[model samples]
Target: MVRSTAPLLALCACLPDPLGRCQTNTDCERGPAGSFCAENVCQGPPRGSIEALPARFFARSETVHVRTIVDRSHGEPAVHVLLGSGAVAAAREPDGAFGADLPLRFAPAGSEGPVPFAVEVKDDLGHLTLLPGSIQIDDAPPRVSVDLASIPSPAAVRGSSVPLRVVVQDLTPVTLVWTAGGAQGAAMQQPDGSFIAAIDTSKAPAGAPSLDVAFTATDAVGNASAAHASIPLTRLKFVTRHDQPIASIVVSDVIWAIAQSEIWILHRDGTSLTKGSTDATPVAEAATDGHHVFFARSDDKVCRMGSDGSIQLCCGPFTPLTGGPILLGSNPIVSTRHTATTSSRLVAVLDSNGICNQMSWLTTVDFAAAMPAVGVDGIVYSGASQAIVAAKFDGSVWTGGHPTSETPSYRGQAAIQGNSVLVSTTSATIDTFASVPLNSDAPTPTTVQAAVAGTVISSPTLAEDGTVTIATNDKRIVALKTDGNIRWNATLLDNATASPTHGAGGLVYVGTAGGEIIALSGDDGSAIWSQKVGAPVRGPLAPGCDGLLYAATDASVVALVIDAAGLADSDWPRAGHDIRGSGDARRPLRSASGACLE
Candidate 1:
C-alpha cells in the first residue's frame, strides 16, 4: 500500500494532498458541492447556473417574491440577493426552490424608472452564479379626465342619444369603461387619442331630471383612475311654468292666458311667443275668432288684439259686465246692468263703429246673468228668470223666455245643441238642464232634469254626439244624454273645481282642488292618466293646438305634454263654446243626415 502522511488520505490514494495538489480528476475529493480537480489541482465547485421564475413586469408599488431555480449538479446549491453591502442567502421555498423577496422599499428613493436587480446562486464549495436586469417596475398610475368641451349644451334629451369623450394621460396602453343611468359599456378609442361613448336614453323616464356619467380608465400595467360628470337633461318638448296663478287660458295659433293682471302669450307648443304686451291688463278672460284676441280690460272696456299682439279696438268704459266678451258675426256682445231693475241685466251689442246697442227685453224678468250663446241665425240667447230667452242683434225679441223651475247657475255658460238651447241649472242640491226650440218663435218650455250623483259644480259641456258632461261637489264626474238620462258617473280623488273639458279620443280632463289633473275615458269613465301640479287647480284647463294640456294652478300656469292632438270635435268642447270663449254656435256643422250645412 502507498504510504500517506494522514490515514484518511491513505485509504483513497486518489485524494488531494494537504497542499491541494492533484494528479488527475480522481485525485481530488469530489461531490455535488465538493472540490473538483482541474489543471492538476483542486480547483473549486464549478460555477452554478440560476434562473428567476415567472418572469413578468411589476408595478413599483408591488412586492416581488423572486423564485430562483439553482443548478444542483455539483453540490447542494444556495440562492442569494446581491445587496450593495454583501450577498445574503435566500431561503428554501416550500417546493424546494430557493428564492428571496424584494420589497417595494428595495427601490432606491425618488426612483421612478425600472429598478435594476440581480440574483445569485452558489454551491457549498463557494462557486457563484447571477441573474441581472431581468425584472422591470412601473412607477405611476394613469391620469384620466373628461373633455368638458365635448359634452353637449343640454347634456341629454329624452329619447335621444348622449355622447361623451374621455382624455387619459398615461404612458402605457389604456382601457376605458363608462356607466350612465344604470347602463354600462366599454368606450371606443378615437384616432385623436381620446375615448368616446354614446349613452342611450330612449328608455329613460319622462320625468327624469338628469343623467349621470362615470368613467374608469385602467392602463396596461394595472394603474387605474376614475372620473365623473352630470349632464342636465330636458324631460319633454313642451313644459313651461308661468310664475302666477292663471284664471283663464285660450289655445289658438298662440296660447293666451289672463293671470292676475298680465297676459301671457305662448306658442302652441308652450314656447314663449316673444309677443310683448301693450294693452291694459284684462279683467275678463280672452277670446279669439281665429284671427284677433278679444278681452275685457280692467278699465271696464272691451279690447281687441291682433294675433300678433297689436291692439285693434278698445271700446266701452261702460257698466261692469258679469262675464267676458263674445263675438256675434263681426261685433262683440257683453252683459251689463239693466236700466230697469237692480236685480235684472241686459245685453249690449258693440257695432263696427263702437256703438253700444243696449238691447233690453226682460227688464220684467231676471235677464243677462251668464255669457250669452249665439245660434246659427242672428239670435243671441241670454239667461232669464227661470228661463232662457232669444234676441236678435237688431234689439227684437225672437222668443219669450222658456219656463223652468231650476235655479240658473250664474257661473255656468250656456250651449246650443242641434235644435234647442241647452242651459245648466240647479234645483236645491240637484243640477238640471232647460232646453228650448232654436227656430220657434212661440217657444214651449222643455225642462230636462238631470239626476246626477252629486251637486253640479261646473257648466254643462256638450259633445258632438249631444252627450253632456259635468262635475259635482261630491267628487264625481257625471255624463248625461240629451234627454237628461245618466250615461256614466266616475269617482274622483278630489272635487273638480275646474269645468270638465272634452279632448280628442273621447277623453275628458278635469282639474281637482287637490292640485291634480285627471284624464278619463268618455265612453266608460275609466282612468287614463293623472299628474300633480303641487298647487290647487281651480281655474279652467285648456287643451292646446298641439299635444299639450294647459292648466291654471294656484301657483303657476303649467303646460304638460300628452298623447292627444287637440280639443275634441264637438258641439261645445270647452268653456264658452271654443278656445276663444266666443260662445258662438253658428259655425257650419255636419247634420245627422251628413249634410254639411248651417
Candidate 2:
C-alpha cells in the first residue's frame, strides 16, 4: 500500500470513458431496460429530447386539454408541442411543464352523429411522437321525425279535439319539443318507439284559424331534427241527434237535448245529467227542478229522463180516483199532464174524465206519488214550488171542473214562476207574444198587431225580468213585458228561418237561416259576436251548465265558448307567435307540427 500498485492507474484510465460526448447521466449509465445513459451525466434521457403529449378530441360545443411534463430529459429541459395549423402556442411554465385548454367551438349542427378530432406532441430535441389514435368529436345534429304512414286531414268542425302521432331517431338521447307557430310545449320521448299527443280545438277561436305544429328533437349534444303539420280550425255548433237534421240545440248540465221528432239527447256534455232523455209523444208539460227535468206524456205515462239520457222513471197509466187507470175518455186528449212540485214531495196533474165518461177534466195526484224534482217547496212560499194548483192534490181535487188555472194547451213550453206564468204564443205576425193577468178576464185575440202578421209556431216565453220572447215565421226576435210594451225586436237574416233560444246571464243565442250562430246583448238587443258553422241549424238553443250554448244543425252538434276576458285581437295569447328571437321573436317555442295543449 505504501507505493500503490502500478496497474491501478491504468484501471482508472479504462473505467468507462466518463466524459465522452454525453449530455445527461443516463447517457453515461445504461443500467436497465427503462434506463439509459445520456450526455456526460447519469440522467434518464438524452439532452433536449421528449415524447409528445397525448392528442385531444372535441365534441359538440366542448373543449380539449393537454399537458407536457419534463423530468430529467436534460440539457436546459426545453420542450415544444405541435398542434393543428393555426393553433396558438400554449404558455410554458417556469418548470418546463406546459398545459393547454382548447375551446372547441366548431361543433356542427344539422348533421348526423359521431364526429372526429386529432392532436400530437414534440420535444426540444426536435423529436416527435404522435398519439396512438385520433380524438373523436361527436358534435352531431339532432334527429327529428314524424309518421307519414297515414295522413289524416283536419275535421270540418272548427276547433275539434284531434290527435297526431310520430316516431323520432337521434344522437345523444333527445327529447321532443312541440311548438305551434310560436306556442311551446315539449314532451319527453317515451321508451316505446311511438308517441301520442292530444290537440284540443275546444279552446281555440273560431273562423279560418291557422294552426301549425312543429316537432323538433334535440339531443343533449345540441343536435336536432324537425318536422311540421298545419291545420285549419272550423267553427261548430251543438245538436241532439247526429242522424236527423238538427233544428235547434240546448245543453242542460250533462245532456245535449235537441228538438228531434221528440226531445232526445244529441250528445253528453258534462259529468252530471239528471233529466235523462225524452221522446216526441207530445209532452203535456215539462218542469225543471234544477237537477232534473220531468215530463208528462200524452199517453198518461209519467217518464223521467236525466239530462244524461239516464231513464229515471216510466211510472204511469195509473188507476183513476174512482177505480180504473186515470186516463182520458177522448182519443185526442192526453191524460197525464202538468206539474207543481212541493218541498218534501212531488206533485203532478192527472187528466181524467171520471169513469172515462167522455168529458175531459183534470184530477190530482199526491206529491209522494208523483216523480221527484230537485228544488221544490210545498210550504206556503218556500222557493221553487211555492204555488200549487187544484190539480196537484188528490182529496180537494177538481174532477169535472174546468182545467186548472195553470193548464197547458197544445202549443209549446210554459214556465210558472210564483204568481206569474210565462207562456210562448204561436202567431203569424209577431215572433213572441204573451197573455198575462191570471185573474183578469182578458180577451184572447188572434193577432197582437193588425199591422204586422206572420205564422208564429211557439208560445211567447217570459224572461226572468218579465220580458216575453217569441219566434215567428217573420224571422224576428221580439221581446215584450207584461204590460205588452215592446222591449226590442231583432230582425234576423231573411234566409235564416231558424228559431232562437235564451240562455242564462241575459244572453240571447240564435240560429240563422244560413248556418250562422249569433249571440246578442239581452239588455239592448245588440249583436255580441256571430259565426257561420256546420249545416243550417233548424233547432232551438239549448243552455249548458256554464251558460254555454249548444246548437244543432243538419251537419253536426257544436259548442261555443264565450269570451269573458274581452281581450283585443292583437293582444290575444299565441297571436304573437309569428315573430321571435330568430325573426318571429315571441315565445321559446320553434314550431307547431302537432296538436295544442291548454
How well does each candidate superpose onto the true structure, as a TM-score? 0.55, 0.50
Each candidate's clash count: 3, 87
Candidate 2: tens digits of C-alpha lDDT, residues 107-191:
3442343333333344444333333323345455554556654234544343454555767664355677777534567664456
Q: Tell me the tens digit of each residue's lDDT in model 1 across 445-484.
A: 4555554423555667876676888778889888877666
In candidate 2, stretches whose alpha carbon ends up further than 4 angstroms from where it belongs are: 1-62, 68-85, 93-97, 106-122, 130-140, 149-163, 180-184, 192-195, 198-203, 206-211, 223-226, 231-499, 502-508, 515-535, 546-598
Q: TM-score of the candidate numbered 2?
A: 0.50
